[model samples]
Target: MGKKRLVSLLLAAVMLLMAACSVNMGEDEPKTTTDPGTKGTETKSGAQKVVFWHAMGGATTKVVDQLVDNFNKSQDKIQVEAVYQGTYDDLLSKLKASMGTSEGPTVVQMYEIGSRFMIDSKLITPMQNFIDQDKWDVGQLEPNISGYYTFDDKLYSMPFNTSNPILYYNKDLFKEAGLDPENPPKTFEELKTAADKISKTGKAVGANFAIYGWFMEQFFANQGAEYVNNGNGRDDLATESLVNSEAGVKVMTWWKDLIDSKAANNLGRKTDDSKKAFSAGQVAMILDSTAALKGLVDGTAGKFEVGTGFLPKPADAKEGGVIVGGASLWMMNNRPDEEQKAAWEFIKFLTSPEQQAFWHINTGYFPITTKAYEQDSVKENLKKFPQFQTAIDQLHNTKLNRATQGAVMGVFPEARQIVEGAIEEVLNNKKTPKAALDDAAKEITSKIQEYNRTVK
Candidate 1:
């Protein structure tokens, strides 16, 4: 069969499967309750109640709950119930299982890696549909934040919590190594020289980063290289991995050299462990997500002066950028018109300047719109925690290209694992950078082909 015909057939199959599945929140009455403060009168008023499944928990959950409460109070015609559904992976699985059913949430918060799958699932109401229907002007949003979800000149989802990678350094450690704390490294070459100096003191590891595929992906993007073919999978479906290219070689070689010199610590693949090592001052520098700034700051408060900087680039890199790492809100299509409209209204409220600023202040996530930075609450938070501004500047300085736009593949998480496995092999001296990455690329290409064949 032709590719497009195959795709259409696969979509139809997915729709049928979705219709057969349903979601149950928990054992107790479906665990899908309306707003608590509604006093059991919201349904009596014939108000549209929308369910929103999200992955945020702990302190972030508190913010989400508060926002939902506010949204409930602001309007009597609609009420939104936010459900905490474990991690992003868990949320995606549940969403898929509940697709096209009444048990399905009206809206979902999907991570960046799941964008391609969600787009092809044929289960979502494109945010563009509502935007155009309401004649909404979304020009206030940051281009880079919205760019990832925009395909074929239309937005597929609403950009919500967003962040990028950055470098976090200990100022005291830099001074102890006889390096100027104010003058941080801008390139990997400079970072190596500084790391060597810091390591000589034996007080702390020079630097550390988790063995994460996303970090490695950022390096490829910073070198102005594509991670996959077909314009980073924007122009068409990606067919193969380009991570074995010269740019990938340069990045991996530098990483291996850093480990060999004992200036870098490989904390396996756990991001939390790397963050803890840095926050405890065991490592002088670390690479982490912008969303971790609040915890890092709070953990290191009164212990040391923390410094933040952009992710280091390669010396020869000319034009490069960092891609966003966060989740976005998507509305489901298999729902009543009232439910969809209510879900869209809830999404709009969540992305408003006031709410975005509140979320940014509480979670340390970069605000999705420019107007959020102008809010009084955000301004006050920036004054107290200036490190948050570095990530914003780093994102603004990024070049807008296919590389920075990031890769969109149906099996992105698996591709990330393949790359991480390659990095581990190179670190353990099992293979050269080229050999490890070449092997990984071959495996990833196979996965891509298999996924496309199944979906198409």
Candidate 2:
């Protein structure tokens, strides 16, 4: 044959060999099938894998891992992977970055204030959807706790770690100051009196409240005050902030007065510092979440007796109650149907009475289900640390109302920072309580408007 013809035959033979190799490689590859309902790869065991992202850290992380393990072992249909995603703020930022991507979690634990934002983002499948489909009786959940996550008559998230603010005091200091250790202050005026006595007795600074905006919001709810207009954003979208209203002024004024009269210590803005002060016997009282009860009680063991009380309100204020605090589990819309279903199963398991009791005992968070109180572990826990009962009683006593339902705003996180700034200004004598709050309210209103515009 001619040289050109030989070269052409050689090239065609090489092409045929490459095609045969490709076919063999394709056959040798694992035969995999994707579920029509899922965009993810299935496990070899055929179990649907659910990715759970949580903001729990420290000791709580261990409990979360244990619960996930229990769920995985309970059945083999679904295998859940629980990931620690740092603090709530950090987790939220990471989630935002992962939006519209498959890298995001099937279920994410978002802080309570993020409800409005989550709803507005339209990135979540409302927990109510699953509840309705399954005909699940939501009445089993604590109304006060669930109310915070419900909007437009729909529950947007499953409450996991619910809590409320409470007054933590040193019983030893109360006795030393000639105050009734058994009868802790119930109102702001009474708290001031007790604080003054404690200060005068040279026991410790009467009280020290961290400049946490959540505390301000709780105080507003306790006094039947709305943090934002339009029925605390439940009746309709809030058009403006009510943080400078009469109720807001009352809280700020009391906080500032406590500092001015040397009845309380200005511990800046760190709740941790206030907690440390209280545990070390350097402060007679501090305001914190019920979740802090175990730590406070254990930390102060033998140093002093710890007393718990309902969050204090103004003596004349009525028709108010504490709003539920803490985070909830949200099902993401981007996840596949199978994955979402698996996530729902995991959520149910977490909120079940037994699991809730376990979680409540391990972590200081209140069990979202009322039935958890009936669990023997919970009963023994409450009896051992009676301070836990104070939180339960406070939650049950809270009146279900627009104000107590808590405010909803897409800019809630930002709004909280503004309120904290106002508190700092008032405490530092930079502005009067009313003036500072008014300024903060105006800024928050502007932010709300901006958020609304963007979401729209």
Candidate 3:
């Protein structure tokens, strides 16, 4: 072969390899090319562009993008661009850093646990302000779902990805344990009894729930117990945590007892691990968010029948309820009137029955509106995946109260970690439930005071 010809062949191969590597690298990066005129880093879009910053990725990202596309195509006055802003923590961090600057999104989807911080930021325009100004009828929204974001009797953010923690069981394991598959436990004591029976079968771990703080929050609400003082911090800023109260102790004690008896396996603090155990049929039952319904169904396909019920109560507690979980949509304030109005329009559209129904059917998150259940797609979802209905019924049955409304604290995320650490300590036999919870409460109170001082 001629020397010049050999060199030409090598150059061609090198160019081909570089092109292949570029294509692979693009897959790992976020799709910032959705709208070339404005990159995601810049908070403000063109006059008509409504920059929507979100934390959705993976398969869920497609659903979010589709929703954005539908909203964008439906109107000519406004262009909606959905940007993936990394994980929830990263999104909050970026949002906090970008506040007070023009480099912030007009609309943001924030998680429920970050509600307090969002409220404290003073960077968001309350949804109720726009609803009242426009005379919008918010009667369609599920009161329980919206109740979480309500402050001073006014709704702040529009609930988007609402959910509830529910008890999921494996019917196949129930049958093996000689328990009725149709009737799952309704209380912690009953769950322990049933778990003991299932454990005896040696077919699977009787129960498994992640050592997550959200579950503890639900348990506190179930006992009509507040997670913080001053009416769960609704009346005023919370200076302390009440998660170490007697009611919280009862819930933690029950959880520790289950682990001690070997009836329930401890999955640590990772919710995914617990989900994996349940999906693999290693755990007969699990307590997980309603959002896990679709994933659980797909993960356990052709394996075992999955049954869902409300999160079990404390057996003696009456007139108690579960708090709403999940994220909501907040519109950034100080934007132009047109941008604000467009943001409100997008929020209204997203929470509308039709759109919410579509979102619920696709994402497995509970729809924010009661009317969403009336939509054909949602109705079909209920029929095909009956487990989805459990959360709806639970929400409807929940008692409207301060505790169930959830606590609002600026250091909520930190408080959640403290609570989770307490739960882990009890589950690992490092401390008694009371001791662990009390310590957690003290640590959380200190953190809250620090956070409040800085924010103020």
Best by TM-score: 1
User: What is the TM-score of candidate 3?
Assistant: 0.89
Clashes (candidate 3): 0
**Candidates arranged by TM-score, highest first:** 1, 2, 3
Q: List the residue pairs that clash in candidate 3.
A: none
What lDDT does candidate 2 reach at residue 304? 90
Task: State every prediction's TM-score relative to the real structure.
Answer: 0.91, 0.90, 0.89
On lDDT, the leading prediction is: 2
Candidate 1 on 1-456: residue-level lDDT in tens? 664455455444433433443321100011222332222223426778898887776567777888888888888889787788876655665665664457988888888877887787676889999999999888988888898888878899998778889999999999999999988888999999999999989999999978888888889888888999999989999999999999899989999999999999788877778888998889998888888888888899999998998899899996988998888898888888888998988888888999999888888888898999889999999999998888989899887889998888876777777788899999999999999999999998987787787775
The reply for model 2, stretches above 4 Å from the true place, is 1-44
- Of candidate 3, the 10-residue stretch with the lowest lDDT total is 20-29
lDDT per residue, candidate 2, 1-456, as tens digits? 553344233333322332332111000111222211222223428788898888777667778888888888788899888878766655666776675467999999988877776776667899999999999899999999899888889999999877888889999999999899999999999999999999998769999998888888889899888889988888888889999999989888898899989999898877778899999999998988888888889988988999999999999997798998888999988888888988999999988999999999998889999899999999999998998888999999999899899998877766777788889999999999999999999998987776666555
lDDT of 3 by residue, 334-426 (tens): 688789898888888897788888898888778888788788888788898988778888989998899899988876766776788888898
User: What TM-score quantifies how close candidate 2 is to the native fold?
Assistant: 0.90
